[model samples]
Target: MSSTQPVESEWDGAKYGREESTGVIFGMEADQVIFIAVGVVLGVLVVMINGFPWGLAAAIGLLIVFGGIGIPRIKGNSLIGWARIFFRSKSRQRSGNDQFVQKDDGVEIGFTDDGEVEIVEGPEFEIMDGSVRRGDDTPRDGKNRIRPGKPVRMSLPGEFGELLVYQLPGGGAFIYDPVLKVATMVAEVMTEKAFQLNSFEEKEDRLREWVSVQSTIARIPGVDIVQLSDQTTMISGASIRHWYEEQILKAPAVTTADGETVRQAGPDVDPFMHQSLVETIMSVENQPVHDMWMAVVLSKEKLNERIVAAGGGVAGFMETALSMMGTIENAIPTSGAYVTKWHSPHTLAARTRTAFDPDSAIQVSERGEDGVAVRQAGPMYAAPRDIKTYESDGALHRTYKIAEWPHSQARLGFLDKLVFAGDFRHTVSLYIKPRDTAKALKANERDRATWSSNDKIRDKIGKQQTARKERQIQDLVQEEDEVTAGHAPLKLICVITVTAETDRELNANCADLETRAAEANLDLRVLYGQAEEGFIAGALPFGKLEV
Candidate 1:
């Protein structure tokens, strides 16, 4: 076998490390030095003329020479020198090699083949003979390996010409490049998809918790429990509806079966029927299930129309319908019967009956000692003018009467007001009894004679009373306007009572309910007695409550 001599490879130090060389001061080459010196001299001359208190003539002459000639050359040289320095330094630093050694201490020494070095200490270091040094440890720890296919860039420190060497992983380094560091950070963050998974899991847990709370609250008896927020709850029930109906029944123009009008004792009739109808329609459109009472109301054609209108289209319709049903089911009507006249335009007369009775009634008393017609009237009796009559120009006579009318003037006045107001669009009432033409004729005759004799007196008295009433009404209207106009009034907001097992349990239940409501995008409010004095009463943006 022929022995081949091993060729000794040249130890090319240049290939292993960056070259360091000294030239003119501050690392500037000879040509740069010359340019810089010239620039400094020109700058000094200009400064002397502008800043110094030289004689005006000398200053003027210097300014002309420097400003017209010297300044341009100086500036040109300065710019050239700067360019040379920047390019040269950048090129040299970029050309530098990197030396990464895996020390026996499980640390690594990373140095630019130039002169700068970085000491990285850890068990993560790994060496690849003559190729590269890498941190083999997991990325989650502090491994310092650049990803493949990326380039390394270098940057030089200001005023020192010292380079801050960076490893552009796939290629080389450039001066002042931050691209490498930014890329590395992004790569690290991208590896953390596990964190995103954890976040999603947590969110799902919260949602599940909210659903459970909603299910719990829905089971409460007699209470229409609603979740208003994460920390608020609303407890409502059938009593609310009862209150609204009561208000409607008490409205000023309501009439009884006997053609007797009654005034509502409180505020205007509750406007909730229309509102409730609207809500019920909306709920039907949206939810699969609805409150029982709401379904009953929506069964009416007129009510359903109002609901559809209020809800706009399907989504609005669904929301309103569900809310109305919920509210109505929970509401309870007051303990009273509603009596309204059933009128048929096709018929001459309509009638209705009520449980209400006058405090007293007219009855003939047993024969007294005097044997005279003893007028025994109860607390209530017929009015004298209940019978009315008039004669037409062509006809012999005409007559009208309200038989067995109530005795009270207040009651009579109330009935009269309802008639004059004509608020009930579809119906009217009348008292009914057997007609007595003779009695009516007698009364008419007496009235005719009295009126013929005292026309002036009657007109004067009527005028005075009318004027007084008109003035009183005007004052009342003005006062009402003023009270309502300038500022918000102190409204007596309605109260809602929720019966719970206990105060503590109620609060806890409310908190949970509110959480569910928030998830459903519902607004819920919870007011403890402490938030305000006495029972809590308030209004919501979309609905009103009356206790």
Candidate 2:
């Protein structure tokens, strides 16, 4: 062990560089094959020249050259060339440049440069660097993330390339080189449209059908009618049934000595009364028809009787009874035709004055349809003429005759008497006026003549006329019976005079009086004018004309 040989680190060039020892060839495989064939051919030539059999050696040399290189070169080139062709054909088949498809895994997709898509089994595939070209130039820089399920014409990060990596439903997409991955989302487009395709005639037919149904339902007897809309209505038959039931229930039940109670017999009943009751209850729950039944129950006479009994007659029963009576009266057709005749002094005056025409001195006529005849002064005895004047010793005297004979009595019928017998304050009025300046001056003679002529005279005359009219109106204000019973009635008449030019100031005063009377619920009437004779005539019985 101590005597072990030293190890050498450096090698001699002759031993390492020798061609036979190194087994090295300088040229390519094809060239080497050619050189070895050439060397064998030269050896064969030397062997032939040295007297060996030439034909066999040359044949052997040729066989060695062909076997060593020619067969392998042809087979290798053929396999590699076919492989390249197969790869390109596969790539083109999977290109999916212009169509869309669903993948087997239902996720991964492929797209081509021509905006086509192909859903695939695995992830998106990308072309390696410099493997695809833009026009004639191959790309050597950058990588593109591709969407397999989308169109291929979609933009990418790098220069124009054949492939792109895209995300699937569950996984992501990545580029081939650098192996970088990125996520993607599938885009969805949606659209909606609305249209009115019905014709006007179709709509009109529907409307007509609705109206026919409504009219038919409205004619159903015992049903309450209610309009819901222009084209719809609700008819309630439940109300009549309920009202019938309530009446039957309250129609005086009898109790026997044996303690058995008996109810009044109903108009009719079906075999399944319980079912009918349940059905009615269910049907009326949500329906507005129930309200009609409620009204019917409330309006029943027995229900009202019960209410009156429970709360006593004074508890709103009078008002309820009055309202019900009014409703019933209004419902009767004959009640609307009833009328009460109104009688006033004007009517009596016209009737009485008819018998005194001037044309007939002994006029005879029947008083009315009752055929009572009346004889009175005729028109000749009633017409007035101017006063005749006689002059003697520079003195003139005048004589005047009566214009017409006033009627002392007038006959009235039962209706006329009835009208005058009640509410006289509302039925009568009086108007007064002064006849002459002499009477006016006499009323105001205590004042200066000028002032009396202008204001004082008119003022005093107005006050007297108002007072006298008021007294006469008061006398008529009570009913005839009441007046006979010695009760003084209201003085309801008013009078106003304008001795001055303006009547505007009187309007407010009249309005105030009218308003006060209205607040007190009085029936006051006012009349105005300026002649004393006319006023007296108007205040008397059988005064004024009636149409």
Candidate 3:
């Protein structure tokens, strides 16, 4: 067999668009403007009453105090704004809304460090004539009972409500909304070629294939592509034991001519040999496995159209979703490395549970079971943020967003080091939203004009333009040119979440991630107060909607 080869290709530099604030005049809010106006009016009154130069000085002092001192800038917000945010956070903490705890029995919920809940028993219900009704013999329908032949409602975290997820056959997840009929299908992407290309030709071939697929997907309206990288360390003893059991169970056996059973020659007959084999397999435990997943979210209209075309029903939903999966598989040929398959409901639940609580252990058998969907997939306990980290189901997490990308061109696989550097468990999620070509071009042109206008204004004011500002203009021009040349424009957001069992371990893993990210020419900024939202965006595959 031929050996696999490495692949390399240069990548264009990236930049983030600046967020615009609309309700501001000269970088001041309406409240600040009102305060200034009121102060100026009071100062004029003082001038009218005192009628001297002292009154004029008092008016100027009032203006300075109201506009300068009261609105002193701290970071991006004024002092008063920061105070309001601080108080709001404190209020949430005091109210215990930021923490949650649920029992396995789904009864008597309680907060970990604070908060309280009172469980009240309610009247039972009964199913009569295929309709659930109250047991009181009154003609009242049971409002909460789950009816048959309808989509099951899933209990999700607040940020992920109005969404339901089910696993497909192989190892894929289908997240959908009952009301909207929109769906996001996720499948594991085997990208070994990314790190195993032998020549520049191979790189070009791969790029061509990827771009061709992207172009096709972009043309399909109401479809969005999201790429995610989920990295986690193997659970050593459990996996080894499971593998060893499977091997012994599947060992070959033969029946003798006399109707006596005979074991296969080697390990089946030798106990010592089996033990040695088990030990050998256990040696590579705790290895890091980095998995890439590609998800496609179909808009409600597109999905409804597919369902109708397939002759609507439960079967129609299944067939339509699978047909879409087939289309994706064809669009991006897997080269026989991996087949695109949907996740079974059980597997979907396990995956979501792991997404929210990375420390949870999921057995191999759980991935193939066809049992009822796992209803309690969320974490048993969660503290959204303790200032800098979020804790959920015993794991402490610190999440970071890419504040900036490399300012210069670099190789495509530059992120390999960051993804596989440390053994600690972490997740790197990349959310890519395809933009309309015409709209994207128009936006870029607008941005270019705005930048030019701002630069000219600065020059007229005797202020010098920075090198970074000049490079930004060039970047926009290059982006516009690429889009004009048939390249699809996309909005990409990346977040990384580091998971650990303890505070110390969490900190160390975070530091390692920072160092690796720096090495990869990525600027990472900690989520800090937004750890929970960051974790969901970084660690969960369902972040397609979040992004």
Ranking by lDDT: 3, 2, 1
**Candidate 3 lDDT score at position 467:** 63
Q: Write the per-residue lDDT of candidate 2 for residues 320-347, one digit (tens) a residue.
A: 3223323422322221111111111112
lDDT minimum window of 10 residues, candidate 2: 289-298
Global lDDT of each model?
0.26, 0.27, 0.61
Badly placed stretches (over 4 Å) of model 3 are 1-91, 103-148, 166-173, 178-181, 192-201, 236-275, 282-287, 301-320, 334-340, 362-373, 544-547
Instruction: Write down the TM-score of every candidate.
Output: 0.14, 0.12, 0.72
- Predicted structure with the largest TM-score when compared to the true one: 3
Candidate with top lDDT is: 3
Model 1, 428-516: lDDT tens per residue?
Answer: 12211111234434543443444343445546667333443333334334334533443111111112222123345434534444343
Residue-level lDDT of model 3, residues 33-125, one tens digit each, is 677788888888888887789888888888888777545655445666666655755777888867767534433221111122323222122
Q: Give the TM-score of candidate 3.
A: 0.72
Name the weakest run of 10 consecutive residues (lDDT summed) in model 3: 108-117
lDDT of 1: 0.26
lDDT of 2: 0.27
